[model samples]
Target: MSLAIKPGKADLHWLLGAMLLAMALHFSHFPLWTSALIVLFMAWRLLLQWRQWAMPRLWLLLPITLLGVAGIYLQYRTLFGRDASVALLALMLSLKLMESSTRRDYVILIFAGYFLTVTAFLFDQSLWVGGYLLLPVFGLTACLVGISYPHGVLSNRLRSRLSLTLLLQAAPLMLMLFLLFPRIPGPLWGVPQDAYRAMSGLNDHMQPGDISELSLSGAVAFRVQFQGEIPAQRQLYWRGPVLWQFDGRGWHMAGNDHAVEKLEGLGEAVSYTMTLEPHNRRWLLMLDVPHILPAGTFLTSERQVLAPMPVRTRMRYNGSSHTQYHLAAGLGSRELARALQLPPGGNPRSRALAMAWQRELQTPERIINAALTMFRSQGFFYTLTPPQLGDDAIDDFLFSSKRGFCEHYASSFAYLMRAAGIPARIVTGYQGGETNPVGQYLIVRQSDAHAWVEVWLASRGWVRLDPTAAVAPSRVDSGINTALTDNTLLPILARQDHAWLRKLYLNWDAVNNGWNQWVLGYNQQRQLELLSRITGTTANWQQLMLWLTGSLLLMALLLCALLFRRKRMPIDPAQALYLRYLAKLSRRGIQAGAGEGPLSIQQRAGKLLPQHEAEIARITRLYLALRYGPHAEPHAEPHAERKTMAELRSLIERLDC
Candidate 1:
C-alpha cells in the first residue's frame, strides 16, 4: 500500500513564529528607519507566503541591500564598530528571511540567530539583558528541530524540550570553564575605535551641560563592595579625572609638564578595590590618591590613576588610596600658574565681582567661603532644566538665571576661586550611589555624574569644596533622583509608589552586581586570584590544565553513560518473547526460516503436526496481531496465545527427532 504525503500547515505556522521572534529582537538595535524597513519586509514576506502577493524580484533585492548598507553608514558615520556592525547583521538577517523558501535557508537563519545572541552579549552582559536574549535562542532552536524532522508526531516539542534540558545540564560545565579559563592580557583582535563610544561612566572634561546629559541616563557605571568598612555617604568621594585648564566655556585636562615626580613621598595609604564598568576612557577612578596599581596601570604626578590601554570592557583593579595624602607639596610657580589659568574673556561680571570680593577678604579661605555663601543665599535652583547661558555663562548663571546642574555651579565656583588667586580645579565623577542592602555593595549609576570644585590651599593641598552640595545637600546624602523631585526628570521608577517594586528593584540590582563582578568584571588579576584560591599559592597553569582536562573527561564519560544506557542492549521484553516462540517451533521438524512470516511458518508447522495445527494457528494470529497492529498493547495478556504456545511446545516435544 502507498501512503499519501502532503505538506502540513503546522510547518508554516512554526516558520512564521520563528521569523516574527527574530524580527522583533533584530529591530531593537537598529535605527527607526531601519526598523520600519524590516517591518515592511516582514509584511511583504508574509503576503508572499499567503499567495496574496509575489516575492520581490532579485533585481529589487540588490538595490534594497545597497540602500540598507548606505543607511547604516549614514546612521553611524561608518559601517564599523559594535553598533554599526550589529545593525548591518540584523538587516542582512531580515533580508534573508524574505528569501527563505528552502530548508537550507532556514538552517542558515537559525545559525545567524545564534551569532546574534553572542553579539548582544558583546554589547551588554547584564543579567537582565541575558534573560531577554534567551527567548530568541529558544525560538530558533525550535525552528531548527521542526525543519529537520517534519514527519515525527512529537518531534518539535520533544526536540525543544530536550535542547533546553541539555543546555541546563551543560550550564555547570560552562561555568567551570569560565572560571578556570586562562585570561589573555590584551584584546584578541583589534577592536574598532568607536566600538562603544557612547561615553559612559565619567568624562575627563566638563562642559556647561555635560553632566546634565549624563544625568538622564539610568545606566549603571560601577558597583563597589567595601572590604573593611563602608565609607559614609558624605565622605564617599570617588575621584575620577581632574580638569585644570579651562577655555571660555569648557574645561580640559591640565598639561602634565608640571606633574609631581614620585608618589612614595605622599602620605599614608588607604587600600581599596574598585570594579569599573566600561567607559571607553583610560582614566581610572579610585578613592582619592592611589599609590599602588596593577601591572599595566600607572600614576601621574597630579595623583590621577591611568590604565595602560583604553578600557573597552569591565575592569577590576586594587589600589591604595590615601584620602589624606598631600600631592605636589612644593607647588612650583609653573604648576601654580597652570592651575590658576582661566578663560581670558567670558564671565566678565563674575570676574569683576570676584576681584571686588578679593579686596574685602584679602584671603583665599574667606573668598572661597564667600562664593559658597553666594550659591546658597542667591536662591540658585538645583534643577535638571537649567536656563541657557550666553557666552558669559558664569556671569549669567550667577546673576541672571541662577539655575543649573552641578557642572554649572562647579565651573563658576572654580573660575571665581582662580580669579581670587586661589588655585582651583574641577573634579568630575559619580557622587552618591544607592547602597544595595542585599549585596552589601554600593551601586553607582550614570545619573550620579557630578562635578565639584577643589581649591588648593598652601597648607591643605587641594581641599575639596562642592558648591552644589552647599545648595542641595540632599543630592550628596541621597541619590540625584531623590534630590530632583521633578516627575519629568525622574525615570519610570518615579511613576510608581509601590514598596514591593522598590524591593524588587533593589534585589535585581544585587543580582546584576554579582553578574558584573564575576562575568564582565573577570580579568587577569581575578584569574590569578581564583587560581590561587583553588590550588593554593603555588598554583601554575600546567597543573590547572591537567585538572581541567581530567574533570572534563570524567564528565563526558558520565554523560555518555546516561544518554546511551537505554539503547546499548537491544533485547526488550517483546523481542525476547518472539525469540522464545521461534525456538519452541524449531524443536519440531518444521523450523522457522530467517525471513519467513508468522503465517508462512504456521502453514509449514500444520503439515508436520496436524494435532497441534489449531494451537499453532492461534499463536501465529496473536503474534501477527501484536507486531502489525496500529498500536501495540504490551500490558494486555495473550491468554489464548499463551495456552496455545504451551500446547505447541508439548506436541513438538512428543515429536522429538
Candidate 2:
C-alpha cells in the first residue's frame, strides 16, 4: 500500500482550522475554566483529525452538553445575562467543532466565527481590542476563502492581501452604518439586572473606604469635553451621589422616606459634554448642578443627572451645570431630619469633643475653621495606610492615629459638622484630573476618586468643604498620584521617565480619545450633532436609514466593479506577427478554424498557397516548437518567431493579392 496520498478535499481541514481559531478567540474573554474546556475540546478535535482518536458518540455528546450547560448555570447562578449567553455560545461552538466532519459543517463554523466576532464587540470596542481582534477575524475569513477554493494550495501571501483589501473596502461602509444608524432608548428587550454589576465607581452611597479603593485603579471613569474654557483643576469637582446619613464608620444616601420635593433653581449654567465610560452605574457625572441634560437623561431632586438604564456601554451626555444653584426651594422637615441623622452610639468621645467646640464657636464658618485647624495643627499625616481602629473609628482617627486618606478626613469632618448642628453631607466623585496636553481634554481615571463635604448654610446654598485639603494641599491643586507619592498602588507606567515612550503613549491615547468620541461614544446626541453639521437639519430615522442604505449600496457597487473588471492580456511581438500572417492567409481564401491546431492549419494553408509553402512551414514550425517543445522559454528567443512570421506573411500576401 502507498503511504503518500494526493490532496483530496482540503475543505475539511480549512474548516477545522477556522473553527479552532474562532474558539480560541471567543473563549479568551470567558472565565479560566470555560477557556480550559474549549482548549480540551480543541485538543480532542485535533486528535480526531490526526487519526489518533475518534469523535465522541452521540449519547456521550448529549450528556456532556447537558453537563456543560449545568456547569454554566452553576457558575453564573442563572441561565441568562451577557456572560452566560456568551459562555453558552462558546460551548455550542466547541461542540460543533467536535462534530465538524463535512464541508457544510465547516461553513457553519465560519458563520459561527463571524457571529463570535460581533459578540466580542459587544464586550468591548476599544481601538487596541478592535485592532488585535482583526488577526483572528482575518484568519477565519481566509480560511473560509480557502475552503471555498479547495483545489489550489492555500497561499498565505494571497490570502493576507485579499483579506486586508476586503476589510479596508468594508470599513467605510461599517463606519457609515455606525454613524448614521439611529439609536433607540435601550431595554428594547429588558436588560438583566446583573448584566454588568461588577464595575466600580460611585455607588448609591458614599462610604468612608469606597473612594479609597477606587483611587487605586487606573481605569478611565469618564472624559469631559469643554464647550469653552476647561475648568481649573481645583474647581473641577464632579458631584455624584451625596451621602447625608453617617453611621460612625461609613456613610449612606438619604432614604426614600426623606426624598426631596423638587429640583433647585439654576443660576449661571456651564454647558459641556461628558463622555462617560461604562461603570454599570446609572448616575451621570457632571459639574455641580446640571440644569439641562441630553434627551435620554433625567434630573433627580438632588440636582444629579441620571440615565434611565444602567450604562453597560460607553455613553455621551450633553449637560449644562450651574455653578450657583439654590437647592430645595422649600426645604422639607423630613429631608432636613434625614440629613442630620447619625449613629446613636459610636464615636462618643468625638461627639463630645464636637459638642464642646460647637458651644465655643456659634457660627458654622467658625466651626468649620476649627475643624480645619484641628486637622492641620494636630500633626495629621495624609497617607494611604491608616491604622485599624476600634468601634470608635472616628474618635481613634481624630485623636489617636492622625494618618488617613481623604475618606477618613471627609467622614470625620462630616461627623463633627453634624455634631455641631450644621447639616453636612459627604460628596463623593472624582476631584482633579490630569489634563492631556495633546487633546486639551481632562482625563479622569479611577485614581482621581475623591470625597469632600457639603454643608448647608442658613442663607447661602450648600458650600463645599475639603478637610483632606487641610492635611494635603497638593491633592486639591494637583492630581492624586502626586499627593500619594509614597503609596505603592500608583501605576508603574506613570512613574516611568522615558520621554520617547511617554510621547508614544500619549499620542496613542490621543488616537483612542478620537476613536471614543467619534465611534464608541457616538450616541443620539452625537448623531444629531454630526447630522446637523453635515446636512444642517435634524435627520429623522427614516431619512438616516435611507442615507445609510444608499451609501452601502454605492460602496457595494463600487467594490463589485473593481473586483470584476476585465483583465487585459499582455501582447507579445511573436503573437502580433502570427496574427498578421493569419490575416494574409485569410485574404488568399484560406482561414484557420477554431478547433484546428496550428500545424494542421499551416499544412492546409501551405497546400492552398504552394508558392509560399516553404515560408509558411518555417513559421509554423517555429511557433509549434515554442508551443509544444520542452524548455522553450518566451523571453529566451525574443523577436525570432516575429521575424519568421513577418517573412511568411509577406510571401503569402504577394502570392495571393
lDDT (0 to 1) per candidate: 0.74, 0.74
Worst 10-residue lDDT window for candidate 1 reads 1-10
Candidate 1: misplaced stretches above 4 Å? 1-16, 43-60, 63-67, 70-77, 150-154, 165-177, 186-193, 261-270, 481-488, 492-498, 563-610, 630-657
Q: What is the TM-score of each candidate against the true structure?
A: 0.84, 0.86
Q: Write the per-residue lDDT of candidate 1 for residues 193-291, one digit (tens) a residue.
A: 565766576776788888998888877777777777777776677778989888888898976665553433345456666778778788887775566
**Over 4 Å off, model 2:** 1-28, 47-67, 150-154, 161-169, 184-194, 255-269, 322-332, 493-502, 528-536, 556-560, 563-566, 570-577, 584-600, 614-657
lDDT of 1 at 85: 86
* Candidate 1 structure, TM-score to reference: 0.84
The backbone clash count of each candidate, in order, is: 0, 0
lDDT per residue as tens, model 2, 1-657: 121222223444555565556556556567788888887887787777678466688998998899889988998888788778878888878887777665566667778877776666665567977776676678677766655554565676776677678788878777777888787755232246555665668787765466777777878888887888887778788988777767667887764454543445555567887878888777888887667777877666566667788777777777887666666545567666766788888888888988988899889889999999999898999876677877888988988988888999999999998888888888888897766779877778877888898887777657778998999988888767667658567654333345787678778878998998876666676687777777878766676778778888888899889889998888655556577778878888888899788889888987887877877887777656555553256455647655655665565455442
